[model samples]
Target: MKYNTILFDLDGTLTDSRPGITKSAVYALESFGFTDLNPDELNFFIGPPLLDTFMQHYGFKEEKAHKAIAKFRERYNVTGVFENSAYEGIHEELRKLKEAGMTLAIATSKPHDIMLRVIERYELAPFFTAVEGSKVDDTGYRKSQILKEVFEDLHTTDLSKVLMVGDRFHDIEAANDCGIDSMGVLYGYGSREELESYHATYITENVSGLAKEILTCE
Candidate 1:
């Protein structure tokens, strides 16, 4: 294999989490006396980190954005995270990659605690060797920072031998930051143009195709 470790993004990549995310976001906005965001507007929040979503999309102040995040978690923790489901054939693809002796890891912008809960809920915890999510600590919520941490955890100094896969510009940027190639998936929430704008090395129509492409890169 060309890469020793593969990093996957959680939301919009491995899982269909829009319904739960949109519901929680709406609840948060309503909690702070904001108007309900339409589906299109809510879609704008999917790929980026939650704090950035609140501040950029809703124009929330720093403190208010933090409160919105807290409110979103109130509902998300209860149901939103559990409401998620893995994409069709993803489990099978992961199994294939694992059998091929490739190390798998999750590098998501979601909070670490919540990511752990979702991973456990979906029964995907065992598939990945590492699950690195956004911490409310100094690393902030950048995808690059998350990937860097995962690479460190893997103890792999050669990032060029690691592949980053996701469904958004953030994923492409993260890979670029780490000097690695990235594969963008069309099955995710983001549009193909968005992925293209970031100049992803490979783009897949679905999970099975993604598996083929990843293996090819090796």
Candidate 2:
């Protein structure tokens, strides 16, 4: 294998979490007095940090954005979390990678507390060597910071042998910033143009193809 360690994103990558997230987003936006938001419109919320997304897209200031995040969690923790489902073939491929002795881990913007719950709910804890997620505080931890912590947890500094895999520009951009290769998956939320624009080292559209890419040298 060309890479010894692989980092996977949570939302829109391993699982289709839109229903959960957008539904909860509805709850939050409604609480913020914006009632016309289409759940479809919240697709951008799938991969990025809620604080920044709200501030950037909805014009929320930091204080109001923090409250919106709280409202998001209010519903998300109770119901929105379980509204997600894993993609077909992902679990089997993750098993294939694990059995092949590759180090697998999760690096997600989902808050650390909630990420733990979601991982257990989806039964994905067994395959990973390390799992890192964003803090539940008011801060939106950058993907770069999250990946840096992941590298430390995995005890690997050879960025050449590491791969970051996800379905968003944020994931690829962070890998680029951290000097690691990245694989952008189209089966998730990101488009080929989005991934290519960010210069992902590899791109695939399905979990099986992703497995082939990982297990093969080229």
In terms of lDDT, the best-performing candidate is 2
Question: What clash count goes with each model?
Answer: 1, 0
lDDT tens digits, residue span 29-63, model 1: 88888784664468666768877778886788878
User: Candidate 2 on 72-163: residue-level lDDT in tens?
Assistant: 98999899989998888889899988888899999998888888888888888888989999876425889988999899998997888899
- Model 2 worst lDDT window (10 residues): 132-141
CA lDDT of each candidate?
Answer: 0.83, 0.88
Structure candidate 2, residue pairs in collision: none
